[model samples]
Target: MLELVVHPRVSARHPQLSDEDVRVAWQNSFFQALRTGSKNSPEYLWIGIDGKGREIEMVGVPTATGYLIYHANTPLSKRVRDEVKGRRT
Candidate 1:
């Protein structure tokens, strides 16, 4: 199991999500993409279902130990949901 380091900003920005919610989402990630073209560290976008069965979207960078999640949200846009569902089929 990879270590999970959630940035403080995650909770600050998304008060509805708890640390455990983020962890479950990461562990259950069904769709992930490497996000390039940033001047900073390489980042990744992950979409997964939490234990409560809610879809969660997370953005973060990989760390030597594991992954550092900086952002997380729910109820993805219709376009994104459609795209992800299409990929699964």
Candidate 2:
């Protein structure tokens, strides 16, 4: 099984991120990124939702099995989160 790994830096934003949160976000981001990936295509910045509907942003690199996670509390993540928060989804 592919172990869902979390980087320590993710704590730079939301200190409340549990292992379970990153795991679920990783799984959701990984599969969704794969579905959108293609040969010769550029990388994608993915926006996915967690079980409770909090938005998660991750970078999808070519040939990568995992994503670079940004818990909604980080500077960059928080900015994106705030920007999208007001929009109807």
Candidate 3:
């Protein structure tokens, strides 16, 4: 059997983005802007990741946390679950 792995990597330019730029990118990609907060003086934004690690499709930057993700191309959650199950020996 062949194992498949998929990971989404944000380009270096993403972190370099100004808050506004990040917002724009977020809006364009996810159709919403994320809220910003700080913990321990470090600013962090909450972005939702599905089981496959891909941001939810077409859902706006969630005003709150706990977004439920579903299939876009393939069911990533199942794949991730399979990977996890495989690792448990």
Which candidate leads in TM-score? 1
lDDT of each: 0.84, 0.50, 0.29
Backbone clash pairs for candidate 2 read 13-73, 13-74
In candidate 1, stretches whose alpha carbon ends up further than 4 angstroms from where it belongs are 77-89
Task: Give the local distance difference test score of model 2.
Answer: 0.50
Best by lDDT: 1
Q: TM-scores of the models, in the given order?
A: 0.82, 0.44, 0.20
Q: Evaluate model 1: give its lDDT.
A: 0.84
Ranked by lDDT, the better of candidates 2 and 3 is: 2
lDDT of 3 by residue, 14-71 (tens): 3332333323333344222222332322221223333334542211222133331111
> Taking the tens digit of each residue's C-alpha lDDT, what string does model 2 give over 1-89?
54444556665556766556656665665223332444524544456556655656654344356444433331235645564454435
User: What is the lDDT, from 0 to 100, of the residue 3 in candidate 3?
Assistant: 23
Between candidates 1 and 3, name the one with more favorable lDDT: 1
